[model samples]
Target: MLDRSESALRVVVRSKFYRSAFLALLIAGIGLSAATPQLTLFLVRDLGTPLPVAGLYYVTNLAAPVAGFLVGRWSDRSHDRLLWFRVCAVIGSVGWLAMAAAQTVWLPFVISTVALSLAGGSMAQLFAACRDELSRHPTKAENRVIATIRMAFTVGWILGPVLGSWFGGVFGLRALLVATAACVFAQMLPLGGQRVERYEDPGISPLPEGRRRLDHMMPLLVFTAICVLAMTGDTIKFGYLPIYMAEQLHVSDSVRGAVIGIQPLLELLMLPAVARLADRYGPLRIMTVGAALGLAGNIAYATSSSVGGLFLGQALTAGLWACVGALGVSIAQQLYPEGVGTASGIFLSSIPLGSAIGGAIGGIGVAIIGLPHVFFVPAGLTTLALVAFVVLTARLSVRMKA
Candidate 1:
């Protein structure tokens, strides 16, 4: 088995196309990840926005991905992946500029939200292009490639927050935004004058005589909804976890920083193993495991008093999140074959929306019930999502067979 896998890796790495695309994705991760948690924390801690309000700020930004979805869908029909990616980069850069220049909270909110939405929204389109270009495999191999692409973003997440914290702490939030914009520019350099091949829109269905019908894609709409629901449980940890750590565990700001830094690193570290698992067991099995781990971790968090307890819970949560983040994109790739760009946009948007909802719930729970309750709600929600994931995926497997 090891020999077979090594042989496969050798074949793939030898391809110039895969290497170039992977390099592009690696650079892209550095830029896109830079602003994520830092911006939210800045708004809450420095800008004096309350937790719930800060959450709403993020929720507003989620609309940008929705726009990306619409734009990507249109691009799909036109078969223009490169055009969409470029447009998204331009819009995202402007958003970062807005973040850097805004005098008031609302101004940054507007700019950052739009910028994040567009930039993030276009990622699916980019992956779709990459996937189409690398369509050289059986189903399992293709799924592994998709999983690896998503894992690349986990690497971005690992770096983004650490850099954001170091830069934001040392210089300022504005400087961090500018740096992120610069990264975006650098990442875009490789794609210059390259025409991206767009895949068949996954949103489209198979019709009579082997033609795909749009109506058959409706099941995927629900699958996307499930993705959104599961992700909310995730976002809560990102947007509100720092505050909770500061207040509940009474950890120092630096310790809080360490905790934040730890999550993405753990996630990135785990992806290769998770990717192998997804290939062997299928995405549904991996997702169910992720959801269950998240549920248990969050529930344990509710009872945690010591810092060690929090760390244990967080480690489990982060590991599970890594699996979902990688495999979710793979599933999305399968579901939205034709409209990959648009579908990717739609799929990516769910994370922020989930974050928004989770943040809102956490904020309210912290304020009224206490921090432990905040942990409890997400745990419960994750458990429900796990059950749903199991049922849905089991049904999806059946549908595929039929």
Candidate 2:
């Protein structure tokens, strides 16, 4: 044990990079997260949009990450991570403002696709910057450092939903959107004029000849594919859990809310431990374990008819996200080792991409299999992906050992 808590952690605690990056992530998380829990409701109930039209809102989720990936790639080339971060936040704020003032039916779609999606790339830039900052001090535990920063965002998500719900109810959805915009703009304050260097490891060993580029990219793509599948399961749970509780389990509002909130809260608690585990057993093995647990968790939700079962299932799935969300970026950065910005962008984009898939899958699966068991759809798909990952990694490992 390196007593990293006293040494590296203290360094993180005292550094300006940690303070600014942590607070920016925290603020941005709250801003974006606060708006999400009520998006469908705002679209349908307040805006008078039809259910079918409202369902199309998830198109924004798919669109944002594509723009984010591009912004990240640009940052690597432009070497202006800080500039994009601030610019994206400003544009995202304008998007929220547009959303608040939206009188036309089609305005939200345009703003989200054109403006806010660019803002979605902001977090990647910040994380890329954080990676650069970490490069300055090799003594720091990289996994733990990144994990610690992510936990701030996790914490914000934990609190944001509650506040958003209350604030929206009391002050109206428009006011809530305005407040969220303010929060988005505030992300720039903590990071104003802050230096954000681009960094990649020069120590990465070259791959075997002829297959260098593709082979080098395999691990990054593999892990990202895993995240995509995992988030699909998560997206299913998130969209359906409340509906499931009301229609099937017949649970009260408080109980349903508790179950909805439990996983992220659990993720906050699990991050440090998973970080330590990555320090020991490595991230990919841990990610595999997480996938296994997520598979089991989804199965639990599919089979059960009771509230307790949902709780148990949610608690189990926390392991997967905790491992993936924290370690996934580092794994991508390490595997790429040429561009942290692009690596992080592609990896972070998995959530939205999987979300786009999850929306379609959840709709079709529910139509066919119905409630509770609809979960098995994502569970089964994830199983297939997991098997592929295992086979590919095993072959890759054998090739390396040879």
Candidate 3:
């Protein structure tokens, strides 16, 4: 009874701001989660697109980061995340609707690349608003807040594929797209009436675009690059792992599903704990450890194919992503505290950017070295990223001291 009560209490989010934000991300995640996995199949089965063309769909996702960065900068400059967020939500709705109505390959591709790309930034706005809200409602557990919000999104990812599979089989892909649009539209509801507490002074004008801020930010930008590289490994493993499972390991589809599903599930469970530890030990140190774990996981993939080996690899890689997905945005927000919108946007943008890079690298790796040895590529990339991160951090510290 006591344990159950504690667990129940642990799950509850007390703040209205947090609860609403959590709910909104969950909805958005569901909308995104459901559509994305089915897109290739939808193209092949519904649109009669060739497998090669469907495979190239990863290129279209590159638009999200580019569009989101612009949106994030716009929201920061305008100081009206609310308006832009709503506009994005509206755009997302229209984009999904357009996708659903698309009868030709060219039309849906255009909608995804253009409209959905713009719509993707709505999440950046949401993260920025949440950051702004906490400024008003101050909390020490900011990392926890971000992690819980991410956990909400993870939950949606877990459910989205399953629900999408069911709905696609039953009501059809068109209905799933319509439902995805509804989820996108509903994102605006949480923060629709919410407002930010903007600080301004009549005596002091805005800070000029100056050298000081750039010097301070350059290392953090380097840090963001490190994260993108680190995350790219996760994407590479994700894109190729199922193929690896079927081909190299001779694993059944069920086993492949379990292996593929393991990381997100473990990520959900580990995120808050990782967040708590991050607050204690520092996100930098924790994330560094996560990077190390990713490198280890990649080596595990390259080295062995036994069940125990696979489990260790999955468990460690989950730790890698748990750190990134849970803490990456918050780290960016903290680093660039003055421009939460822009910082959040940049962090959000890194994901699709990382995915695009990862997909390209994975494809090349498969061709060059064969699929069995491809994990070594990510292992090598993560090691290089970690070395660069250490060098950059040391330089930043030395410069600060001087």
Which candidate comes out best when scored by TM-score? 2
Candidates by TM-score, descending order: 2, 3, 1
Candidate 2: lDDT of 392? 56
lDDT of 2: 0.80
**Clashes in each model (backbone N, CA, C under 3 Å)?**
18, 0, 0
What is the lDDT for 7 in model 3? 26
Best by lDDT: 2
Candidates in order have lDDT scores of 0.68, 0.80, 0.77
TM-score of each: 0.86, 0.92, 0.90
- Runs in model 1 deviating more than 4 A are 1-12, 40-55, 136-139, 200-214, 252-255, 399-402
Where model 2 places Cα greater than 4 Å from the true spot, the runs are 1-8, 200-218, 392-402
Evaluated at residue 302, the lDDT of candidate 3 is 79
Candidate 1 differs from the real structure by a C-alpha RMSD in angstroms, to one decimal, of 3.8
